[model samples]
Target: MEFNEIIERIVKSTNLSAEVLNSKINDKIAELDNLVSKEGAAHIIANELGVNLIDSDASQDFVNIKNLVGGLRNVIVLGKVTDTFPVTTFEKDGKKKQVGSLSLNDGTGFARVVFWDDSINIFKNIKENDIIKVINAYVKENKFGKLELHVSYRTKVRVNPDDIDPKSINATDKQSKAEFVDIVEIKPDSFVKCFGAIVQVYKKNIFFNVCPQCGKSIKSDEGLSMCSEHGKVSPSRKMFVTFVLDDGTGTIRCTSFGRDAEVIMGMPTIEAIKLADSHEDSTFPVDSIKSKILGKEVFIYGRTSLNTFTNSIEIITSRIVENIDYNVELKRIAEEVEFGDKN
Candidate 1:
């Protein structure tokens, strides 16, 4: 339970004013040598007052995104869907399984909700901007140390529940807005936009194989392309580019995939593929296009994630904007200044 909710419960059960409850919570904090957070102190106070803050039935209460921790089971959460991804299929133990994911924001923070197997059917009905209530979910930390809410067949989902006030979800569309910031100010697990010049481009190992049907990476199996979901199939070539971007504040490594990679290369996938075929060198396409993108200025909007191997934050580009207009940029700056002055 959140601190404010706990305090509300204590006030109702023990007939204590909110101010008095806060005072006692503060005293508890000081008594513990300021080692405990206000919410922890509030929990202790609720315990001493014989007030049960946690609901006897866990599914009835919603847990705030900020309070989520790993290993939590039978958890309930309510949030606005910020993003959804395509469902992917895989084979495990001679059985096929599907997985899908979406991002949720509850005004406290954002979390990724993963659906497995039959649970993906629930995800198929979900869309961006919808308010959802998830019951009987479990929490686990991803390899990157980010908390994720996993939904299985036993979990229940309510889409835009009638009891929830849409107005109460302050972060309904907040995560969709990408704040433009300097590369130096970028943090992990955040959506951001930046304007920078491509300082360096890595030209080798630019192409990868993907299953044409589902667009997932495919592997070479005995001289045949094999997709875990599609079995043996012809694979299509996909492109990705990694480069260092500098905006005078700092430099960050940014990666662009597929169409965005083609944009950066100033060439289409077919043309690049033919170029590589002609030379019989898979690295030839990047070698041909590297000079054209060096020192090119562009705007990138994407999510930042920690690259654990590098111990640094990197951007996985969602969209890349090139050929910027100086006049439009000046007008935007003027409007921002005017709005700031009015506020």
Candidate 2:
């Protein structure tokens, strides 16, 4: 789990305000002297969350916040709900599934608790600054190589009895965190990261006429055109390019338009359309545009959607990074985590 994941999980699980919680966490960390102490102390707002560490005489094991690691199963922990991320819904096998998580902290350290599917409802009721105990939760690393808890149907989430009402923490800090994700995991999420190589480019209908006002495909009436949705209108040319991206495991057909398509074509949409229109009767500059992208590498920050007509996933490219080495970027991230080390 990343720091934002930790911060988000806490903000959502308790009634505490995110703005206040962020401020309090940052202020606590700023007071610490060294990296290790700063990291550990940053988690537990002792008076704010009212969490305590306990041990039983039995042989059963319980992990601490700072000791959390990836790939741990049947793990249990007791912590205060610190913060939470916004709830997100995604489709899996044609059915919708919801996911949410909360940041949990004992005095020793901090961790993220993720809720999935039906389990997400329980976490939904949990508010910030609530004292909660989770049993039978599992741990895993996210795209950024940090530990987070993944709770399942078998996991137990409960609110501990307390006499006092929950209070909001000072969540005023605005530290930012971002990470790149695999292309396979791309879906209708935020501006997520994806990298792949262009396997093929489909150039037919790369540029076409659309209604200037509403952007719907137009019906040609000699010089003037008619839009089915908007009636009569002037026509404007737009780029709509389709291509294939291969990421070793699979291939996905990607469709991009306007500015993103122009990035691959190396020219403006109007210019390409004019060059094609110069021909006797050309729909688009098929051969010229295709020549620009076949077999090239690309990194796209785009939006993914499931096409109901095809019932398959497709991408709408927003930003493109042509032929950049991703391995080098990952190495740089690792170096920053190990040395500078601010969570």
Model 2: ten consecutive residues of lowest lDDT: 169-178
What's each prediction's TM-score? 0.45, 0.38
lDDT of 1 by residue, 99-164 (tens): 677778888877778776678888999998899999988786533335678776558988999878
Candidate with maximal lDDT: 1
Off by over 4 Å in 2: 1-179, 187-191, 213-224, 227-231, 281-284, 324-343
Candidate 1 local distance difference test against the native: 0.81
Error at 77, model 2, angstroms: 45
Tens digit per residue, CA lDDT, model 2, 210-312: 8989888898877678998888887788887788888776677788787767766656677777878787435456576566567666666566778889887
lDDT of each: 0.81, 0.64
